[model samples]
Target: MQLDRTRIVVRQRGVLDTLDLALHVLRVYLAPLMIAMALGALPLMLINHLLIAWMLPDADNLLDIPARYLWHMTILIFLQAPLASVFATTYLGQAVFHDRPRLTEVVREVRKVAPRILWSLVLIRGVGAAWLLLLSADRYGEFDSFVDTFLPLVLVTWAIGLRSFRPFIGEIILLEQNPLVGRDAETITVGRRSRMLHGPASGDLFLRWWTSAGTAILLTGTVYGTMLFLVGVLTNDWRQGRGMLLVAYPAAIWTVATYLTVFRFLTYLDARIRQEGWEVELRVRAEASRLVAWLVVAASVMCWTTDAFARESTDPIEAGRQALSAGPSYPWYDKQEDGLRPVHVQPARESALNRGSRWQAATEDPQRESSWGTSVLNALAQGLRWLGLIGLIALLVALTVLMARAFLMREEPGSDDQQAARGLSPLEADRIDNLPFSITQPPKDLLAEAQRCYQQGDLNQAMIYLFSYQLLALDRHDLIRLTRGKTNRQYLAELAAQPGLQRLLRPSMVAFEEVFFGKHRLTLERFEGCWQNLDTFHEDLQRLVTP
Candidate 1:
């Protein structure tokens, strides 16, 4: 379950690894993280002490009004945003290497990602605030709901659960070499990447979803519970309205924010590992490094052992006698005037796995020059590749045809209910609307009746006339059967079988109810559009029905 942080590989794992990784980040970066938070707290503390406390109507009350609660968060997040940016970026840097940046560098990194951090904080908190407003009915804008109230409980649960969705938002922003701008850029990127993170429906996000969500809930509970307990004890008055509740809440908020920041870095790597074959890459590098180490060990052993070994003992006693009589046993030992002196030796070259991996990598070298035979063989291979591609395409086409045939042959479970939105009865289509101005009579020609309604500016009747034109045309073409009642959705569903009809008629159907039943004003442009659509359907119907 312990990940090799050096290789930075993610694997298909269960829940235990998720908790382990979260704790791993906490253990490894606890010191630097505290320092970062301490620095973050400086600004937040200043604002809370000087500005926010005095500004609130009842400074001590954490649950006086929803507006006050909103104001508290607005100020808190404003100060925390820059420091959070620093925390996220620094964790990313350390995730790459054990070396975390210095304070100044962390600050610089934060400044670099200030736009993304501030904007994201604003957006998420803004959304959270909106949710609170809609759900909680107290003061429109203040957090008057107490700790014991359902509102706070709901807010806490929501915040905890919602963390998983945007886990990589901070990482994406800070690490995105080319960043996106505008309101929903971060939102768009997070949603897009979440697809890759969770993966396809077959696995059903089992790997990413369960792990991240579970870890989020667990960490939220553990961190917030401990902090809340501490805040209560320190304030010595949980029941009394102390502003420390405000401070305590922010502390818990920052703790989760920071923890998730680091935790998400690992999760992001896991997503990459699944998507990019990082496990394979890491294995290759590890094997290469092991091979290189064995080689170095063998070389060192050879250098100092056996007959051919350069550093093997050449009779130390004899060499000492020889040093006094002649010079030295070997030329490597300097015949210094003051006995044997140390020799300067060159350091062994360190072998990197990356270099060895490149050496052992599966690759083919291109021929600088080709012979006639080689050229002919290459041309033959290229021809074979094209033939294979064409064969594959043909096979795919055959497979698709088989699947479609199977689908068409299969009987639907509900024969009665699943019947195509059938052609309407004449009585149904020509039913009198009984409008204030319109004459109540069935028309001989449905299209002409529709035209008459349009001419009279009876939009309600005109829309119904247009719908009748579609149903009649469809029935004439035998595309649908007669049904006494066919809802718009039912029509659209049945029309799905006929792509041309679906495409041409879908918009008109959707607009039908709105214009006819929902008080749409009469307009020439609208009338013309509806008439043109009906006319288009009638022409297509004639062509299909003619033969």
Candidate 2:
């Protein structure tokens, strides 16, 4: 019992330490992330300002409009906000949980992708502007009557366009930084490489985009509505209604949320593509389908309530007796005399039994009886059913998972003596368990071996070890596949072809490329750092690799 208690305490401490590290990483990366978002937003804001200046110069209420537009544009460009939260959450998540790249390294990589990000942003803004123009034309009745009748089509097309471009900016940023070369990229490549490698497929991209957009709209709308309700209540002045503010807030929030969601989805999608290839698309579709199922369930309940209410609002006796009685002879009803008979008149005691019988016969199921007050009751019940019960349960589950994950992603702090004695892996469990990390190699002893080879004047051997170590250990999975006693050049070439490790391995590989292949000298400090990283990487590998 004492030993069990000690173990529990140790586990708790481990979890707490991991959370602290994650929070620390978040603190370190938040500033640069905000800077990146701000940079992304600048052009969009400028464009919005230019549009306002050109189109609405004389409007006296233009100041607030610009503020709103700025908010919207910020969301459109940056994708998610509390911009600080996204940066903090994502960067920290990657650093703490996945050992793929350091915070600074990832930021540097993102910086390199800025041009691609900017181009995608420009394309997105162009699409938005074109949509606004079409909407304006529609409002002004510029189209023929037949064309006007297809307004829904126009709206759907606009929606599709918005959805399709939604992921591109983020996708470009992520892919540019983490380009999968060789087999890793090839395994995930779908369609004809010719077609898939170009612009995103309309159907698949739009599905993801629209699904993200819908979620953003729903979440933002709920938040906005709550705020509006609170404001209305607090002011006690419905006459000075700020309900319009709600609409504007959702639009602005939607812009930002859409961007964030798309970016997040793209990151996951890319990771999934790298891990499981085209199956990522299927997983996304499955998620969308689940959401659709929820919506369908909600809609079906509403429809049932509406039908019940329509039946209940009429006098029950009048609906059942008057409508069903007298058959063809009834003034308000028409029916063939022999084909249909009037409802049976029964004694009061037997009336309940007769009603039950008729109801069962009509419904074709005894269990599906509709109460007289079902309409109003069902309407109230539906809201309570979803919001009170289902929504609360979902919220609780989400919170639990987040907290659990946060706890799980901590390093177990202890002395090296204790770790070694306990046979604990040097690489923390928190560091190697989650995404990107799942595919990354643990830092190991390859650097030391490489250095020894360098000192021995076997420059090619040293280069191969360094290159393979960096790629197989730092960027890819835990496993290192060294060719069986192969020459340095052969081993390095083979390592380059490993799926999912090449892109991350490329930079360090480049460093070695010059040192060995170009016969350039490597600095002691740089070489030592690589060695240290390799030791840590080895520790990580021990944790990941099962005996």
Candidate 2 CA-lDDT value: 0.45
Model 1 CA deviation exceeding 4 Å by range: 1-10, 37-86, 99-104, 112-166, 181-241, 289-547
Question: How many pairs collide in each candidate, listed in order?
Answer: 14, 15
Q: Write the per-residue lDDT of candidate 2 for residues 39-144, one digit (tens) a residue.
A: 4344444454443223222343313343433333333333323222332233433442343335565566556755544444334334344335434543333335
Quick one: best TM-score, which candidate?
1
Question: Residues 1-547, candidate 1, lDDT per residue (tens digit)?
Answer: 1223462334654445755776776777678776776676656556544534443455445356445544445434532443454554555555564455576777676678677666664355343343344344433344444522454455444543444343455566566523553363123344344443442221423445456546555765676568657766976754424343456555655666566555556666665565455665556666777788899999988766664545555787666667665753553455545355666789645445446564544456686787999999999999999999999999999999999989877645653232223333434433322111123334556677777877787866777667766765675566765453334545565676777777777656544544543445545665567567655666766777678
| lDDT at residue 98 of model 2 (Cα atoms) | 43
**What is the lDDT of every predicted structure here?**
0.56, 0.45
Return the TM-score for candidate 2, rounded to 2 decimals: 0.32
